[model samples]
Target: MNVFEGSAGYYGRYRPGLPPEAVALLAGAGSPSSRPRRLLDLGTGTGLAVKALLDRFDDIIALDTDVEMLAIAETDLRWRLPAGVRLSLCHGAAEEFLPPPGWRADLVTICRVFRWLDRPAVLARLNQHVAPDGAVAVLADRSLWTATNPWQQAVRSVVQDFLGPQRRAGSGVFPATPEPFGQTLRASAFSDVTESFVPVRRAWSADGVLGYLYSTSFAAPHLFGDRRDHFEAAVRQVLGCFSDTDTFIEDNTFVIHLGRRPA
Candidate 1:
């Protein structure tokens, strides 16, 4: 299966275990009443963040490159959308999606999206969409399940080796560090650059973790190929060794960045 196909179920099913810092950063963008009458959600995979934004903004535009992802989002939104909320989904990259003339948004949000973007181009395009006084916020989660724990160090090493090539080529998406990413934001015309880190923990049953692994398009080949059964069995054993309980915890860090266009 392709990346989006194999991975859809995982990201599509997993709920956003948003950290408080992320919430605060979003709130800092503007209060609901003060929020831009117009808003945009860039890389709105499955519309999780879009749903949250809708609570504050009555007019919204969401863009995603994946058509299937948008389809899933549309289904979810149909059920929970509030009255007066309007959403338009654009099937294209953030840098390419054009709003109407004199279009300007009060707020622009890119949650867990930048890792997949061309940093420079996206920053420029995002700048263009925001009203002079508007704010743009970007959020990303750094997966540290393997890196932080001494027991998981070996697992981290193995996973790193697996993802090494993709990381080098910037193909894996998402940055492992925030320094360089923050630098790009700083170099832009945006002001009041503030970033906060929030720690999150997710509990997963054995099958759930297995499903998550299989859902990764990059790791699917390793998890579901000739060694499929073997790999799953090994995962069960490794997780079992790590936990005395039926579930395991994924400890991660989410970083939120907030900046504003010049007024």
Candidate 2:
């Protein structure tokens, strides 16, 4: 659930490759000249989202619980950020941090990491930090649409063949659909709660597909242990059927739910 620690090295590897909704949500949140004076990126991971925020905010603070992830985030900022942008990297569970009394922020965003917690609780927590008349965006990708791709049969065959009950019992790739998730936010005191979906198609080669899966926690045990070769072989067998000219299309659906903090 700690995406910062989970997706460390792979962070931002797919840059310029994010879902369209992600870009749109960022835009809807506002631009540099008009962006909120203060921005909070919860569960920031390696800070890619926050990096974008930095372009807007004169001061930005990103917090994550994983030390390893924050370490990399700090290094990335030093190496990649332009001068004059104030950045602070805090290490701790996001829920543990409280905005100072009477403190409210212009923007509060959690991208790709909010679904890991109990939805209602997290929404309530995020709502507490938003400035009145301010906005919040919770960004997520629904990976289950991969089932619509031509290769779904093959990939499911292998996963069902090897991972069996685990696949069913463990968390499925996508979290809540757009509607229910938005309702959770509405219930937590956000007004004008609206959900928008963006469809993004990511095309990757056979090896790229396997690499993406191997990067996941579900696949890591098999990817790093005795079954590593076996798992790779199964993935390759399914993906290798594609021609070099052919690309595997993964339907990356991002749901953006926005609400205004009541005045």
Candidate 3:
């Protein structure tokens, strides 16, 4: 089964975005031209990141491989954007995105989705669309599976107890360790690679945690099969042991790796 199948709704509701200051930092990393700034957001997910960037870019192309996810973003942003601002939501792979003639992306964001792309091919593609002084930001925040909070651990334990140990992602399994995305950026054509971390603390209630579980590729609803309700119950039971009211404070450090080509 596709990991993202039936996961779009949950993703839009539960996935947290970068903090406002971090969004400002990401927007500032690029040098866009006057009048209309263009932003190419790859793996736009629910368009949450694009929504955060509405004021940052006048012309935005939010692209995603998942048609369902892109549709949701299109629906949400269509109403939120001011009149006259250009918003084009494309449903396709990042490499397939062809902007209008003379359209150059001032900043391109690959948020929490490096696992889904061919790193070298994407870099090569960016060289064609991105401006000479443009910036590319690879962004991500820890998910429940990777989070070390006591409540998060309990949730993972419950998921493993139901899904049987190996973490499933799409048709295969996720790596036991984290991928080195920064190394890939450093080796790409975009030079001046730098890393930054933005700390954002959030509190998750039982409902929030439960909703987030279904958003992940590893713990997606289909992975539970007919036992999804049972899995939720088990997760709730385990979570109760962690907090009385079933809420947990999670301190997340959002990561940003910015790379830019020489002007």
Assess every candidate by TM-score: 0.82, 0.79, 0.95
On lDDT, the leading prediction is 3
Assess each prediction's global lDDT (C-alpha) against the native: 0.67, 0.62, 0.83
Give per-residue CA lDDT, model 2, range 1-263, as digits (tens): 43222445544353323454566566556232443366777888778777665556655678887676678778877666556766778886666767657655667777756656566666677667766666777777654223567685576567656666254312333343334557767777776676878878777776665555544444433323576678768877777675456477776566788766554
In candidate 2, how many Å is residue 166 off? 3.2
Model 3 error, position 146 (Å): 1.2
TM-score of decoy 3: 0.95
Better of 1 and 3 by lDDT: 3
Error of 3 at 179 (Å): 4.5
User: Model 1: which ten-residue window has the lowest total lDDT?
Assistant: 165-174
Off by over 4 Å in 1: 30-32, 144-147, 150-179, 215-217, 221-223
Candidate 3 local lDDT, 1-263, one digit each (tens): 55788899989889887798778897786785455888889989899888998887889888888888988887888899976789988878876678788998889999877767877788888889988788899988888888888778888989889887888885579855645778888788787788999888998888898888888898888888889889888888888887897678898898888998754
